[model samples]
Structure formats: C-alpha cells, structure tokens
Target chain A: MSRVSTLLARETALAWGKGGGPMVAVGFYAGVATLLPLAVGSEPERLAAIAPGAAWVALALAALLSLDRLFERDYEDGSLDLLTLSPVPLEIICAIKCLAQWLATGLPLALAAPVAAIALGASPQLSGLVVACALLGGLAFSFMGGIGAALSLGARRGGLLTAVIVLPLFVPPVIFGGGALASLEAGLPWSAGFALLGAYAAAAVALGPLAMAAACRNALS
Target chain B: MIPEVSIQSLALSRGGRQLFSRLILKLSPGEAIALIGRNGAGKTSLLRAIAGLINPDEGEIAFGGVEPAEAREAIHLLGHLDGLKSSRTARDELAFWTGFGGGAPAAVEAAAARLELIPLLDLEVRRLSAGQRRRLALARLLAAPRPLWLLDEPLSPLDAEWRGRFGEIMGEHLATGGMILAAVHDPLPLATRTVEVGR
Candidate 1:
C-alpha cells in the first residue's frame, strides 16, 4: 500500500478500535438525541418541528467531542514529531487525519441521525434529506474543527479551548444544514441551502488542512 | 554515504530566557555526540533544533550532502515520548510505521528481533513496560535506516542487559556510516565525543 493509504488505514483503525473517539462521539450524540424528547414534551408536532434542529445541534456537539484528540494524542506521544520528519508534507498528513475523523466520527453520526430524527417525530419522507445533509455537514465540521483542534495543541486546557474555538466555526454548517432540512420539510425548494452547505464543506476540505498544518508546526516549535 | 552535519552559531531561547547561544558543532558520518547538561539546560532543545523539529533563533544547520528540504528524511528523532499508540498491538504499530516510512518489512522484523521485541509484538503497546516501550521506539531507528539519529535520554528506562544490547546496536549503526546525537546524563559506550549544552 502507498504511504497515504497506510496513514489512512492506521488512523481508521485507531478511530474504530475499542475506546476510540468515534464511539464516544456517537454515544454522546445518542445521549443528546435521547434527551431532547425529555426536555421538551413529546408532542408529535413539537417534536417533529424541532427534530432537524436538535439533530444538527447534537451532531455539531458530538463532532466537537473528538476534535481535541485529533493532533493532541500524536503531539503528546512524539508521533507528530516523526510525522513532521517524514517525506510527506504536514498538510497532507493533516488532511488524512481530518478525513479519517470524518469517516470514523462523521460518517457514523450521519448514518445514525435519521434514526434520531425519526424518533424525535420527524416526517419519515425527510429521512433521506436528513442523512444527506448530516453527511455533508459532518464533513464541514470535521475539517473546520480540525483547525481548532490543531490550534489548541499544548494549551493548558486544550480540550475546552478547542470547543471554544470550534463552536463558532460550526455556525455556518449548522445554519446551512438546518436551513436545508427546514426548507425540505416546508415543501420549498431546498437545493440552494443544500448547495451552499456543500460549498462550505468543499471549502473546508480544501483549506482546513493548511491551517492545521501551520498549527502543528507552531505547536512543535 | 551519510552527510556531515554542521551547526554554526545556532541559538535557541524559550519563555524569554536564552538557553544557549553561539553553539557550534560538527559531526561526520559514523561519529556520535552525546549532549550533556543539567536540568533546564536545553539539552532536549538543542537536539530538537538539530532535528529540524524546532528552528534555531540564530545561525544555520547545513547538511553537507543533502538538500534542506530532504534533511528530515535522513534524521531520526527519538524524544522522551515513545510515539507508540497504546491501543495498537506492537506488530500493527510497527507495520504502520514500516509502511509509512517506506522501509522494507523485512527490516522492521529484523529491528524487532534485535530489540527483543518479538515476544511483545502481538501485545498491545500499553501493556508493555516503560523499558519495553523505549526499546520498541528505538526499533524505529532500525526499521527505517536514517543517517542521523537524534536520541534523547535513551538509556534512563532500560535495564542493564537492554542497555548493553543498545550499545551494540549503536556500534553496528555507527559502523554503517550512521551518526547519532543523543541527550544523556549517563555515558554511552559508543559516544565518541561529548558536547555540553547550556554550560
């Protein structure tokens, strides 16, 4: 296998193995999804009305749960140093790590969102749209959150700092995703919002790694 | 052949305090330089600067034969942190590095055997003791052959036998035209020269 594939494989394995970040994020997402019904009474109309919003919020928070670990673990363990020394550019490594985070945490959360949305009384017809939006939005979150994660490395309270930094970046995705889902529910043309969200995700994937690579270099220095 | 490393007036400062300045050193193939210093003396910092993990505040580090962009590929840095993932088995960890480093799988296996890590290869890295972890990390020095080895406090956690074994490995690496720069309090048998940092 090639170097990039080998790195992706290693990261995927780490994220899928026992006690991995994906499990924690998924569990947190499930917990948040389950609690929305309790906090706001189970009126079908009310639940259905808020289903998409709640799911999006939960997804954002869950993704945040794992962002802190992105570069922190490798940084703490000296792997980042070796990684920097390797032939591959640090930007490529950062991109691979973000991609792995998307696959491990984002993909599963996206797949599980429909179930949560349905449980919250979302119209069954919108389930497909919910999944699609979640997948795209999750990609944005993973890549953008990577910037925060990398920036906060070596900070005294790095995890909390990551959340503080990442939550703001989550706004664009949340608005775009929630708007797309809401438009679809209202029988309105939702392509515009969905397209905007897709554009944000694409931009994130293209640019997040550059910022992350710079952060990693600064932290190492 | 491995290139010679030259550092001229290399200096580093942290937290607004100057650790050292006007530092100069020259190392050729097959020579080992042991960096000795007190705590807070920047021994680790010096090693890191040479590895290109950190940029020096002043002056230059030139590789006689390699391009600056390619210098990192020729340097192996073993800091205090072992870099092993605790959750992964030793075999998988080694395999991932072997693949990533573009080294031969056969060489990784040989390195593992040399470090007496064969028994622990199937075990999770978290299960291994500190000495074992250090040895496993050292295995990377062998897994991928690099001209310059930057090792920091490599002997603190090892038992006498492993230490002796490590000395032998160092001897072999040096014989093959590899250079080592290590931060150490205790003397190493293979270190031909000692540089005192922050003195």
Candidate 2:
C-alpha cells in the first residue's frame, strides 16, 4: 500500500479504536443536544427556534473534545520525533492527521447531526441542509482545531488552552453555518452563508497545515 | 558502501544553560561510539541533534553522500522512549514503523525473529515487559537497517541474556558496515570509541 494509505488506515484504526473514538464525540454532541431541551423545558417552539444553532454549537464542542490528543500523544511517545524525520514533510503530516481527525470524528458527527436536529424539533425538511452544513462546518472545525492542537503540544493545560485558541477561530464557521440554516428556515436564499462557509473551510484546508507544521516543529525543537 | 557522519564544532544548550559546546566527532562505517556522561550532560541532546530532531546551537553535522534534507532517513534513532502505542500489538507496531521507513513486510519478520520477538508478536504492547519492549524497539534497527544508529540507554531493562543478545546484534550490525552512537553511563565492550560529555 502507499504510505499515505497506510497512514490513513492507521489513523482510522486509532480513531475508531475502543478508546471511545467517534463514539465519545458523537455521544457528547448528543448529550449536549438532549440536555439543552430539558434544561430550557420542552417548549417545542423555543426548541425549534434554537435547535439549529444549538446543534452547531454542540458539534463544535464535540470536535474540541478530541482535538487535544491529536498530536500530543504522538509527541509524548516520541513518535513525533520519528515522524518529523520521516521522508514526508511536516506539513503533509499535519494535513494527514487533520484528515484522519475529520474522517473519524467530523464525519460521524455530521452523519448524526440530523438526528439531533430532528430530536430538538428542527424542521425535518431542513434535515438535508443540516447534514450538509454539518459536513462543511465539521471540516472547518477539524482543520482549525488542528492549529490549536499543534500549538498546545507541550503546554500545560493543553486541552483547555486549545479550546481557548480555537473557539475564536470557530466563530466564522459557526456564524456561516448557523446563518445558512437560519436563512433556509426563513424561506430566504441561503447560498451566501453556504458559500462563505465553503470558502472558510477551503481556506482552512489550505492553510491550517502550515500553522500546524510550524507549531509541531517549534514544540519538537 | 557506508556513510560517514562528521560533526564540526557542534554545540547545544537547554533552558539557557549551555550543555556542551565546540564538540567534534566523526564516525565511519563499522564503528560504534559510546557517549558517556552524567544525567544532565546532554547525551540525548547530542543524539537528537544528530538525528535532526533538534537544531544545534552551533556547528554542522554532515552525512556524506546524502543531501542535508534527506540525511535523517539514513539515521535510526532509538530514544529512551520506545515510541510504541500501548494499544497496538507488537506485530502491528513493527509493521507500521518498518513500512513507514520504506522497508518490506519481510523485514518485519526478519527483525522479529532476530530479536526473538516471534512469541510476543500478537500481544499488545501494553502487555509486554520493559525488556520485551526494548527488544521490540531495537527490532526497528534490523527492519529498516539505517546506516547510523543513535541509541539512548539501549541496555536498560534488559536482563543479562538479552543484553548479550543485543550486543551480538550490534556486533553484527557493525560487521555489515553500520555505525552506532549510544548514550550510556556504563560501558559497552562493543563500542569502538567513547565520547564523554559535561566535563
């Protein structure tokens, strides 16, 4: 097999392993979605109004839960040293890691978002849009989160630090994604928000690895 | 053909403290260098610098016949950390690393057999003893066969028998024109040269 395919396979195994890989993130997302309704009382009107935004927020937080361990475990075990020395450049390594993270956590979360949205009384008609938004929004979250994970490599309180660094960067995606959904619900053209979200995700895919690779090199050094 | 590593006036520092400076060493094929030093003497730092894991504060290390960018592939560094994922079986770990290093599947089998790791191949790394883990880590050397080996405290956790086995492996490697630079407090009879730091 090709080196990249091998790497992707290994990452998929790690992310799908018994260690609560995608399950934990998706569970967290569902938990957050389920609790919001109970905490605010089962007012369908209110829940329907807030469901899309709440689901987006929940997905963002769920992605955050797994981002800290993205590179930190490899760094701790000295695998990062060997990886840095590999024939692949550090940027490509970062990209591969983020890609794996997206495949494992983001993809599952995206697939599950519609269920959560419908449970929270979101328009079932918007379910398709919810899935589409989740996929794009999740991609943005994973790549942006990669920057945070890489920067916090050797820092104390790394998980908390990563959330702080990444949450701000997530604002644009959240707004664009949520705006797209809210506009769709209002019977308006939502293409503008969807286009903006796609652009944001594309930019993250292109540039997140550069920041991650630099952070990784800094942490190693 | 064998590779030679030349270090000219290499220097390293950690946390604003200069660990070593103006050090020079060279190793041709079929030679082993034992780096002897105290705990804070930067033995691992030197090895890491040579492995391209860290930048030297000063000086250059050149691997003859290899581009500077590609030199790291020629150096096999086994640090104090075994670098194995506890969740992975010994077989999977070896296969992943060897394949990553561009070695074939046959190399993994040969390495496992050489290290007497056949019995433990299917076991998770978490189930292995320290000595077993060390041997598994050492197996990477055979699997990839890099010319320069940087081993940090390679003998730790090994019993007398395994230590003898490891020595034999090192001897065989040198006989085939491979080089080693190992950091240790105690001496190894197999080393062709010794460099002490933190004087």
Candidate 3:
C-alpha cells in the first residue's frame, strides 16, 4: 500500500510538472470564476446564489479536462499494456493512477475554490463549505472520470469522447456538491450530502479500477 | 521443474472482435521464443495475453506454477513504448522505476552505460531518438530482476549495432535461466523458437 501510494505521488508530481493540461484547467477555473463577478456586477446575493453552482461546474470541468490524458497517453505508447503485465494487478495500478489524478487535478481544484468563491462574492463561511465540498466531491469526479478516460483510449476524438462519456456520470457529484453547499448556507444539515459524496467516492475507488482494467483489456484487444 | 509460463487454448475477444483464438504456448526457464505475425496479426495481443494484460476469452494462462496475479512478482513486460514517460529525463525515469523495481542502482547504471545511455541520462525521453528510446527501454528491462520477460516489438528502430547488443543481452538472460518471449518481424540472432499468429 505504501509502495502504491509513493508511486502515485511520484507519478502525480511528474504529471503536474510536465503536463500543461492540469495547469491550464486550473487556470481556466480561476479565470472563469474571476470573470463571473465582472459579468454580474456587485450583486452579492446573486453571486452567493450562483457561486456554488459555478464552483461545482468549474471543479467538474477541471477534472474532466485532465481525464482524457489519464491513460490515453500510456495506452497509445504501450505503457498501459506494460502496467497490466506488472506484478501488480491492474486494480492497484488504476488506484495509483486515480490517486495521482486526484492529487494533481482534483486537490488543486479544491484548494482553488476559495479563490473562485471569493471572486463570486461568497461569504467566508460559505466559501469554506464550498472548498470542503469540492475537496471531497472532486475525488469522486476524478475516479469516475478515470473510467471514461481509460475506456475511451484508442477511440477517435478521444478528448471529445471522454467528455461525452463522462459528463452524464458526473451529474451525481455535481448535484450532491451543490446540495451540500446549499444546505450549509440554509443552516440545514449538510452531512447527508457529504455522506452521499463520500459514498460515491468510496464506490468509485473500489470499483473504478476494475472497470478501467477491463477497459484496458478491451482497448488492447 | 514446471515451465515458467504456460498458456492453453487461449482465446480473447474485445467488443465482439476476436483478437486471438485457441492459442497455445509455453516457456520454460532458459528458453527464448519469438512471436511473428504481420500487422494486426495479434502479435502484441499474444504478448499482452501471456503477460496477463488482457484476459483470454476461452483459455487459461499459468505463470510459474500458479495464476498470473499470483506469479506477477517474477514477470515483466516491455512493450513498444518502453513505458517511459517522454517528459521525464532518463535519469529521473530510472530513479522512479528503481524505486519500484527494487533493483540496485549500481546495476541499473551499469546497464545504462553498456547501452550507451550514460551521456543521455539527463535528457528527457522525448528528446531521444527512437533507437535511443528502444535502448533505454531495454536498459530498464535489464535493471529489473524479474525472471520472465514479455517483449512486444522489441527491436523496432534499432540499428545493427544495438540489435547485436540486444541479442547478446537476451542470450545472456537466457543463459541465466531467464525466459524471454519477444515479438519481432525479423530474425533475431539467437537460438529461438518461433510462434506464428494469424495462420
């Protein structure tokens, strides 16, 4: 487990440093969030209302943007085939890749939510909840998106294909994430939403890799 | 002793496309086999199936004397990409792989030198020529201590010199009771058994 974690960390660091995709996605998230205020103009109530939705959307988009390259590059280059042949099961490899992807893209998006929230005139308390929801919710997005990314390898227009395949699946996270934030704002218990989000993440963590391994097998075949 | 790896009546299909059907093969320690086929002939698929990358639809593969996941610790597969991330410097790639491979750094460095990658260690993999990348990939294989090597198109872009060097290394590996299954289009300069696919 430690070995897998270390490998995941190392791979994530490498991907974050070398690939412009993650950075570009984060940049776009910040850029879009920053522009929202200008477009809306001093409407604090309006900003607060739309802030959670925008943040959720941005987080999802950021995650989706990085999904296509998750395994496609390795698959095309034959590295994924080698990974399957590793002494490690493809499940472990997929888990490691997901960990890396979440850390590289999802974690950063979570951390960046505060900035996005502030840009949309969210109060400090609401902003904090937004970040929390994003931190937990974004992991589920990464894991689920990984499945789409892995399955779409070798498909024509893989980037577009990834988005098309993954977007419908992403609705769960988006809904629960926004609901969690709204519940927090309304002084309602947000734990249920958080719990639901956590459950999704857990399920994705447990089953996503196996699905990905099957997808890889299909792609190779 | 039982062979290091064996497959019986292996059949594989993906999305209803039958990539391979009823394939049978085996490899004992100290044996080397070459897989030959035309493009789309399933040479890579065969290597992948043997390495457990793809599950066979109608057969079983046993490694050492057990299942693939059970015998994974002793198996290594090298595909066309060499699995090296082009963005990473060769040294960084080696360091990262060594961290997981559990092999000695000295041995890896020595293999790098022998492969003439010493000077290019700091260069990113993307900067290396195709032949260089192939050698670097082979160097990685040398660094690993696994007993079974499943290679796909192992000699795609090598010149005559590197090809000879690869042959020598493979010969040495076989001499040491290591098993090798390589997919190649041309003849390799070693005592080898050939398996033709898509017949």
Per-prediction interface RMSD in Å: 0.8, 0.9, 2.6
Q: How many backbone clashes does candidate 3 have?
A: 1
The interface root mean square deviation of candidate 3 comes to: 2.6
DockQ of each: 0.86, 0.76, 0.53
lDDT tens per residue, model 3, A67-149 = 88888888877777666655566778887888888887788788888788767766678877777788778788878888999
- Backbone clash pairs for candidate 1 read none
The TM-score leader among the candidates is 2
Clashing pairs in 2: none
What proportion of true contacts does candidate 2 retain? 0.63
Per-model CA lDDT versus the true structure: 0.90, 0.90, 0.79
Q: Which digits, one per residue and each the tens of the lDDT, describe model 2 over residues A33-125?
A: 989988988999999999999999998999899999999989999889988888888898888888888899999999999999999989989
Report the poorest 10 consecutive residues by lDDT, candidate 1 chain A: A14-23
After TM-score superposition, what is the CA distance of residue B92 in candidate 2 from its true location, in Å?
0.8
**Pick by DockQ: 2 or 3, better one:** 2
A168 Cα displacement, candidate 3 (Å): 2.7
Which ten-residue region of model 3 chain A has the weakest summed lDDT? A1-10
Candidate closer to the true structure by TM-score (higher is better), 2 or 3: 2
lDDT of 1 by residue, B162-194 (tens): 899899999999999999999999998789999
